[model samples]
Target chain A: MKLETTIQGLCASLKSARAEQKIIGFVPTMGNLHQGHLNLVREARKKCDVVVVSIFVNPIQFGPNEDYDSYPRTLEQDSQLLETVGCDYIFAPSVEQMYGNKPRLTNISVSNITADLCGLQRPGHFDGVAVVVTKLFNIVRPDYAFFGEKDYQQLAVIRQFVRDLNMPIDVVGVPIARAEDGLALSSRNGYLSEENRQIAPMIYKTLKNAEQELLQAKPLDEVLESIKVALTGAGFIVDYVEARSLELQKVETFNQDVVLFVAAKIGATRLIDNLQVKYIS
Target chain B: MKLETTIQGLCASLKSARAEQKIIGFVPTMGNLHQGHLNLVREARKKCDVVVVSIFVNPIQFGPNEDYDSYPRTLEQDSQLLETVGCDYIFAPSVEQMYGNKPRLTNISVSNITADLCGLQRPGHFDGVAVVVTKLFNIVRPDYAFFGEKDYQQLAVIRQFVRDLNMPIDVVGVPIARAEDGLALSSRNGYLSEENRQIAPMIYKTLKNAEQELLQAKPLDEVLESIKVALTGAGFIVDYVEARSLELQKVETFNQDVVLFVAAKIGATRLIDNLQVKYIS
Candidate 1:
């Protein structure tokens, strides 16, 4: 359980693991680990000889108006949770350690995949993710990298870049981890007020209902409108509720595997969740 | 020497080499190998246990109006030259092999440093270079990558991205390979007519004179003007002649390491060259 706070230290640790012919697995996260992140680490532990979990609240990914300054930092609790999950290394680098004094001159942009959904609402978000994740991949040089299906568009974006750039790492998307009430686990959930926390479960429930409606040949636009109405009815300020193909492209109806995506603000905290609906009929 | 035309073939070959703990050195080039490119290979031979040279005339890096279609690709002769230079593998992937039917969705861009000089003249040039070089680095995963200082700005761009991205490979800039008459050897030089070939060496001479003038504390603007006049007098269309800091930023004087860059056209062939001026005073 090594805690590597610098790129040099992380590389040194990884070099040793690589020398021993170990299959390294990487899980990159924005710290404040929840059950969702721990599940990723546990999956890494099951599949790999060494599992490295990075905890950095990437400033680049957040827009100027977004939650960059107030993002959660729970290293003490996050480290404990990761250790309990049998993680081999925790790469928790400071912003200075990662970016230094110079302006970030290098950027990795993935088009098409990043042009819709969360990408449109949060511009430059996935490009920031693309850049940082690339740096992490270069630093770790892992055999496998784990990403949560909870961030469905993010997972798609990563997969797109990995294939287009010909990076030699398998990108595995783990299923979304949800609460007993069906609310998807997110670090941002901590920002929810007690009342909003209770209402957050509706985000997932809306997706489930939308999934059922779509699979039963309901009109895509109608089901989407219902989701917006349901969330807005429950005191959630609907950001976007749309049905997209599994590739995250706009769809008129569910002919193949379609997904229901929802994002909204309950009080000041914004939450996002999506569910895939496979048409059996 | 093995010629690997497919990514799988190259990886399989590299796998056996890595298993034996070989340090790989890479030199990326556009074929029609000249003395400059061969020199790069020879240096790679001297520094690494296994040398892999990639001859990819990357279409992404060339502008629509540029010479991508007409770019000379002498793979047969180039392969022979690489063999002579002790290059262990020539990873010459075809356009189809490198990029399938899909569009190139991933792009790596470097700003600031690429905001001037050749970067200004050719829009999206360094970005194209950035993306292709990143893909090459990912594919080869070399311990060291070599570049010719002849393309000073390109070398600077590569170094910046590799460092900013925290790529493990060390970037080595080999000295510019020159002919007896002082013209920087280039594949583009093949396009020069016999009369233009005689006039081509003037590009190097102009850079040298600019270097001496700047080192002698001459006015930077005056020296730059002289370079343009000298090339224009030789029946060449002077594109730009400017002085920049070694970091490729605009400089007012020769108080530090300065570089004199020149680009011009003779007949239909465009030529570029530069020389470094180390101001000792």
Candidate 2:
């Protein structure tokens, strides 16, 4: 298992592997490796000749008021966990090394789709994600790249970008790895207060209830209203409870290609979750 | 020479070439192949084991009122020209084939540099160029890509984009190919009347005179004023003339990385040109 820090060093290592026609499977993440990230690495290991897991807490992706400075930097633990999971390389680059100078530009932005969801809440957030992912995709040039569906909207946007730009890599999306209590694993979960942490599971529970209600042919709007009621009842500030197309970001009335997405503020910590619904006649 | 209109066929051909460790050189053009495009193909043949040329008159780069429909479609002639130049592959895909039912919603924008120059006059022009270039780059996956400095600003923006995004491909800037009369080769030249065609050489001649005058260490503003005077006197509508950094898009003093860029309207035909100048104290 090689541990590299600079882009040049990592490229040197991968160049040799590429010469041998080795298929590289990459999982790019910020360095707060939780079960969700490891799950992506595990999936990569299962499919490719070489596995590269990059831990870059890309500053560009964080907004000015976001937790960029306070974002987790547990590199040592992340490296050990990767090694335990039989990972081939861990690329840990400094902010300067990763972004040489403030990138003078941004890349492929999905329009109104992103404009509403998390995009509206965190302005320029998806732009940062799009730019950094493009940079990483170019740097790695992996045969396959993995992303856990824990960041569902991100997964959708990236899929759109890869197809839009015709980037030649298989974007393998793994299912969201969850805690035993059904809470989706996230790096931000570490910021949760002990009391807020107790209520985090309810977010997922509300989504599950919405899914069950929709399964009974409840109107899409009514299902959303019910979920909003439940979340607000639990002392949460509901950002939005809406149904959108899984592939396209269109607001759906008939529930075709629909995914119920939710975001709420639970005692100062913003949490998000979603459930996929297959609408049937 | 193989002619492929589908992405799959091109991919297969390029993939086989890659397996043989062949260097693929790509020249992405907009189909009405002139002497300028032939020069690119010839250069690719000289330097690379395989040459791939893509002819896509991208609609994204054109303004709402621009000549998307009137743009020349000389595919048969273009292929014959490529074959004469020893080209290996020609990729021509329809807009529908290129962008599926749900076009992937990603943007690959260059930056502030592009937003000026042609980008300023033709809004979203560079964005379209960036997106299509990205798509072509991915599809061809060429080791080296060629661009004509005839579209001087576009070449500079692409260079900046590839550098900033850390994209892994060598971008070769080929000098503008001109006619004996010093008129720059452009497909759009066909749109001009015979009288306007005769006066087209003035665009190049004016820039040359500006280059000669600037040898006296004249301020850029003065140089630009002189060029604008020469252009307007020649019955041309001068759009803009300014000295800007070749790397950075802002106005810069002499001895910096700079190029004198100009855009003008000759009758109904719009033309752009530039000259790189050095300051010798």
Candidate 3:
């Protein structure tokens, strides 16, 4: 596998790949690869002729108060994992290589989708995500880009962006990869204390309970209340538990595509999870 | 010229062009097909293997009170003009084609630069411009994108965007095309009354006057005030006339790369102009 750190080197490699009419697949991540990320890479390898994985801990996505400083960086282990996944290229750029000396003044801000859910809690997060993804998309010029639905809102926003901007990229959403205990796998999952890790599974459990209630024809409001009550009952500090249309992000009766999402704090660490319900559409 | 109204057709055509390793040049315009726009096409023809011109009268760029309703739609004339310029393809997608039923959110925001200039008069105008341009860049995937320097702040914003997002396309700024009378060419020039048209040259004349003063080692404040005084004295409602770094958008001394820009209203019609000054760098 080829490892590149500069844009020039990466583009040269992609250009050679494209010249052969090779289908290019890309998986963008913040390093410290877990099974969730490997699953995205494996999916890319399954679908495309060449797969490239980028490991850049984008500073822009984290808010000043968020885990920017504490985010995990497991480069050596991540590189070993990528080689084992049959990845073709690994792009690991230093911050200076990606961003110049001056702070970049232009930024991308997604509206409607970013106005609620995680966007509401961490402002400018999606904007940062959008800008970096745009940069990576341009750099990789992939035929298919894989993202796991573990970050449900981010997936929605990115899918929205690719459509709205008419970007010539196929953004494919993979199912959320989970740990043995049903906790949604996240790089941030590493930050969870042993006790908090035990409670992290509650986030996904709460969503499952909400999904089950919707299946029973519970009113949307009542189902939401029960999920919130369950999470709060577990001593978790709930940020928000929302049931929104997977496509429109509007409150909907459980007769259409819906995603029941939850974000909450267990001790000092925050966790998020969601489950989709394709109701009788 | 190949005429495509849907993105699918355009991309399919572009794929063929890419397989041949042709460098595509793109000129994106809200079409009224003024000489300023034609000049961009002509420049694109000279620089690229394939030239694509998009005639999208973006509704997002217009404010609720602005002239979106009255915006020109002369596609036949526009296409004929583009054909005359030897443009390879013309993308004239409808509002529905560009934006699906549920429009995906936009993410391009240009700040501070938009704060004091025309943005002051038309709030959210630059944001709309940035969003539309990003969409165009992604769709066209041009090797180089061309813009006229007439929209000085817009050129600055887009330049920053391509840099900040690390977009692959090189943004090339062509000098502002002008009429024989030295008035900068704009489609909005169509809205000017003949009486206003005659006085429009005053905007350019006053900017040139300020450029002359700066070259004579005059203070930035003195040069700016002199231009404002000249325009207002000429029965024009002066908007703002100031000098800023062409790159950084800060009020810079008369020591380096700076652009002196002005905006004013003659009757109800507003006009803008600028002069780029390269001091001893």
Candidate 4:
């Protein structure tokens, strides 16, 4: 597998791949690869002729008070995991390489969609995500880009961005990979204490139970309240638990494509999870 | 030359071109097919294997009170002009074809650089320009995209967008094209009456005189004042006349790369022009 640390090197490689008529698939991630990231790489490997994975802990995406400095960086282990998953190229640019001497003044803002859920709690988080993802998409010039459904709002925002911008890339959302105990895999899970780790699975469990309750025609507000109560009862600080249309807009009826999204804090670690649920009337 | 009005058709054609390893150069314009627009096409033609021209009078770029309704649509004549210039394709998507049922909610904003000159007069103008140009860049996926320096701040904003986003395409800023009378060519120039047309050249003349006066080492404030006064004296309603760094930053000294920008109203028509200058100590 080829490893590229600079945008120039990645483009040079992609140019050659384009010459040879290769279908490139890109999986962009903040490294410290878990099974979830590997699953995205595996999805790319299944679909495209070449798979390129980018591992950069994007500083801009984290809020100033959030975990920018504390974010994990395990490049060596991540590289080995990617190689095992058959990723063809690993683009691991340094912070300096990604952002030069001056901070970027260009921003891509997706309105409406980014005004809810995680976007509300973490302001400018998705804008930072939007900008860096756009930069990576331009650099990779991939035919297909894979993102995890674990970040449901982010996936929606990216899809909206690509559609609105008329970008050539096809964004595919991979299903959220979970632990055997049902906890959604996340790098931030590293911050969990052993006691908090024992409590994390309950967040996903409440979401799954909420999905079932939704099928029983419980009022969305009641179902949401139940989920929030359940999480809080289990020592999780509830951020929000709501049912939304796939567009991230609040939906009253479960008649159409809707997702149940949950964000809560277990001790100091914040975790998010979502489940797509359908109601048959 | 192929004419595509649909995004799907354009992408299909571009896919074949990519397969054949053609280097596409794109020139996006609001179609009235002036000499200035053709100059951008010519620049693309000189460097690329294929030249694609998109004539979209982007409504979003015009302020609510601006001249969007009166913007010319001369596609047939524009296509004839593009053919004469060896443009390989003309993408003349209708307003409906370009933007579907809903208006775009995604915006690309370049801060600091877009805060001066024309941006001050036309709020949300550069944002609209940035969004549409980004959309065009993605749709065409050209190797090189050309813009005229006639819109100096626009060129600078685009450069910043491309650099900050790390878009794969190289943005080429073609030098401004002017009429024999030295008035900078613009589609809005069509709005001028015969009497206004006769007086329009003075805007350029005042800018030229100011450029010459800058070599005399006068303070920038005095130089700017003189140019504004000259335009106002010539029956023009001056918007602003200022000297700024090439990056569109306000500059106190003309010691480095700087551009003098001018905007004025000739009767009902608003006109803008700029000149790059260097000072030798």
Candidate 5:
């Protein structure tokens, strides 16, 4: 496996791959790889001739109060993990290498998709994702880019902008990978204390319950309210528990496909999860 | 020359060009078939194996009070003019095709460079230029993109964003095309009356005089003030007469290359022109 740490090295490798008519697949990640990230790479391995995984904890995506300083940087171990997954390249660029000393001034924003969901709670988050992904897509020029459905809104925003900007790249969304206990895999899961770790599965459990209620054609409001009650009662600060259409628009009825989204804080770590309800009625 | 009015048609042609290993050059303009626009396509013709010129009258760039409705569009003349200049394709997508009924939510903006000049004069103008050009570049996948320096600040913004976004494009800035009277060629020239057109050359003439003063190391503030006085006395409502470094930053000394920029309105028609002073101290 090749480890490219500079944009120059990455471009050179990509140029030769393009010349040879290789189908390149890309997975961009923040580098504390777990089962979910490995799953994305494995998916890429199944389809593409060359798979590149970019491990960058984008500073611009983090808010002032968010954990920019404490984000993990285990490059050595991350490289070992990716190598086991049939990855061709690990692009791990330093912050300076990616953005340089100057502040990034170009903003690639998607208005509607970013107006709600995590966007409401975290202003400028999706814009950060949009701009950074644009830079990565241009630099890598991948045939296909993989994103996990755990960041469903992010995937939606990326898809929207890729179409809007007419960027010639196909975006693929891999399903969310969860533990046997139903806890969603996340880099921040490392910050969970022993007690909070045990309770974390309750988030997925509640989402599953909400999914069942939604599947049975339960009232959207009552089921969503029950989710908030269940999580808040479990010693969580409910950030939001809401239901929207498959398109992320507010759902008035369960006539079509709908998704229930939840974000809540346990102790100090915030966890988010969503469940899509494919309705029959 | 082929005329492609849809993204699909343009992409198909570009795909074949890439298959044959042809280098593509792009020139983007809003159509009125002015000498300045043709000059840009001519530059692309000399360097690239296939030249694509896009004529898009972007609506988002126009402020509500500005003349989006009155903008001249002569596609027939523009196509003939491009064919004469050796252009390979003329992409003239309808506004609906370029941006669907839905609003284009992506904003590719350069903040520092766009903070002054026409950006201050016309809010969201460069951002419109930034986003639309981004779409065209992706659609064309051009090896080299050409711009006329008649809109000097617009070229600088495009260069900065292309660099910032890591887009693999070589941006070539062709020198401005002017008339015998030294008036910069522009599509907006169609809006001027015969009497106002006769006086419009004053904008360029004043910039030439200002360029002489800067080349001779004249006082920056005094020389700029004289430009405003001369144009205003000629019955033109001066928008701004200022000097900036070649990098588009305010200049305090003539120790480096400097450019004098001017914009003035005569009888409701706004005309802008600029001159560069290659100073050696």
Candidate 6:
């Protein structure tokens, strides 16, 4: 597997692959790889001739008070994990390399869709995601880009970005990979203490129970309230626990595809997860 | 010349052109087909094997009160003129074809540069231009895209967009094409009465005089004030008359490349023109 750290290097490599008419698949991520990110790579490997993974812990996506500085940087282990997963190229650019000495002046914004969910708490977070992903998409020019459903709102935002801009590439979302206990695998999960790690599974458990209740035709509001109460009762400070359409739009009644999203703080680490449930009437 | 009104047809044509390794040049327009738009095609023809021109009078660019509805749609004449210019393809898509049935939720915005000039008077105009141009760029995937410098701010915004977004295509700015009387050619010129048409030359004339004044080392502010006063004195409602750097940023000194821009209303028609002057000192 080839490792590229500069934009020019990666473009040159991708250009050669394009010359051979290779179908490129890309998975962009921040370093400290988990099973969820590798799942996206495995999916890409199955469907594409080449798979390129980018590991740049984007600073712009983090709020001023967010854990940007403390975000994990295990490049050595991350590289080994990618190699074992049969990844083709790893683009791990430095902060200075991705964003030069000056701040970026361009921004791509998706409206309405970004106003709800995790967007309400992390202002400008998705805008950061939108801008960086736009740059990466241009740089990679992959035939298919893979994004994990773990960040469901982000997947929806990216889909909207591609649709709105008429981008030629396709966006594919893989299901969220989880721990055996149902805790959605996240890089931030490493911040959890031993006891907090044991309790982290409660978040996903509550979501699964809510999905079951939804299947039984329980009231949407009641299911949401019970999920929130259950998480709060388990000592997690719940940020949001609500049901939304697959497009992340607010739905009055759950008669279609809906995802129950959850964000909560257990100990000092914040964790987010969601489960999509189809309603049959 | 082949005319394609649908995105799929144009993409297929351009895709075959790409396979043959032909260099494609694109000129995007709203299509009343004046000398200025033709000049862009001519520039494209000189440098590329295929020249595709798109005539889309984007609705999103125009404010609710602006002349979007009244914008010229001279498809028949425009097609004939493009054929005469040896253009390979003409992409004049309908509003619905380009934007679909629903409003576009995605927006591409360039900061700082777009906050001034025409962007100030026509809010969200550059955003509309950015979004549509982004779409056209992706669809055409041209090796080179051409723009007339008469809309200097729009040209600057596009260049910024390409650079910021890392678009693979190159943006080339052609000099403004003018009539023998020195009036810059524009589709909106069709709105001018014969009497207003005669007075329209004064806009370019004033810019040229301002350029000459700046060449004589006159203060930038004095030159700008005089130009605005001259246009207003000639029965025109001056929208803005200012000097800016090539990037459309405010210029406090005349020691670098500067463009003198003017927008004014003559009778019921509004006219805009610009002249670039290089500073020796």
Instruction: List model 1 lDDT by residue over B1-281, tens digit each.
Output: 99999998999999977877789999999889988998999899999999999999998889889999999989999999888889999999998888878777888889899887788778999988988888888899999999999899999999898889888899999899999999998989989899989999999998888877876777888999999999999999988888788888888877888888888999999898988888786
- Order of all candidates by DockQ, from best down to worst? 4, 1, 5, 6, 3, 2
Instruction: Please give fnat for model 1.
Output: 0.88
* TM-score (all chains, Cα) for each model: 0.98, 0.95, 0.93, 0.98, 0.97, 0.97
- For candidate 3, lDDT tens digit of each residue in B152-181? 888888888788778888899999989988
What is candidate 2's fraction of native contacts? 0.82
Off by over 4 Å in 3: A202-210, A218-220, A232-235, A278-281
- Candidate 2 chain B weakest ten by summed lDDT: B248-257
Docking class of 1: high
True contacts kept of 6: 0.72
lDDT of all predictions, in order shown?
0.90, 0.86, 0.87, 0.90, 0.89, 0.89
What is model 2's DockQ versus the real complex?
0.70
| Residue-by-residue lDDT tens digits, candidate 6, A108-181 | 99899899788999999999999889888988999999999999999999999898888899999999999999
Candidate 4 C-alpha RMSD relative to the actual structure: 1.3
Show where candidate 4 strays beyond 4 Å.
none
Clashes by residue pair, model 1: none
DockQ of 1: 0.84
Residue-wise C-alpha lDDT for candidate 4, range B1-281, written one tens digit per residue: 99999989999988888889889999999999989999999999899999999989999999999989988889999989999999999998988887778657788999998887898989999999998999888889899999999998999899998989988889899898999999999988999999999999998888788777888777778989999888888889999888898888888876786899999998888999999887676
TM-score for the A-chain in each candidate structure: 0.97, 0.96, 0.97, 0.98, 0.98, 0.98
Clashes of each: 0, 5, 2, 0, 0, 0
**Residue lDDT tens for model 5, B77-119:** 9888888899999999998898988656677778887888888
Error of 1 at B165 (Å): 0.8
What is the per-residue lDDT of model 4 for residues A1-281, given as tens digits with 9 covering 90 to 100? 98999988988888878899989999999999999999999999999999999999998898889988888889999988988999999999998888887758899999998887998999999999999999999889899999999999999999998988988899999999999999999999999999999999998888888888878877788989999888888988989888888777789877877899999998888999999987566
How well is each residue in B40-143 modelled by candidate 6, as lDDT tens digits?
99999999999999999998999999999998888999999999898999998888888888657788888888887788888889989999999988788888
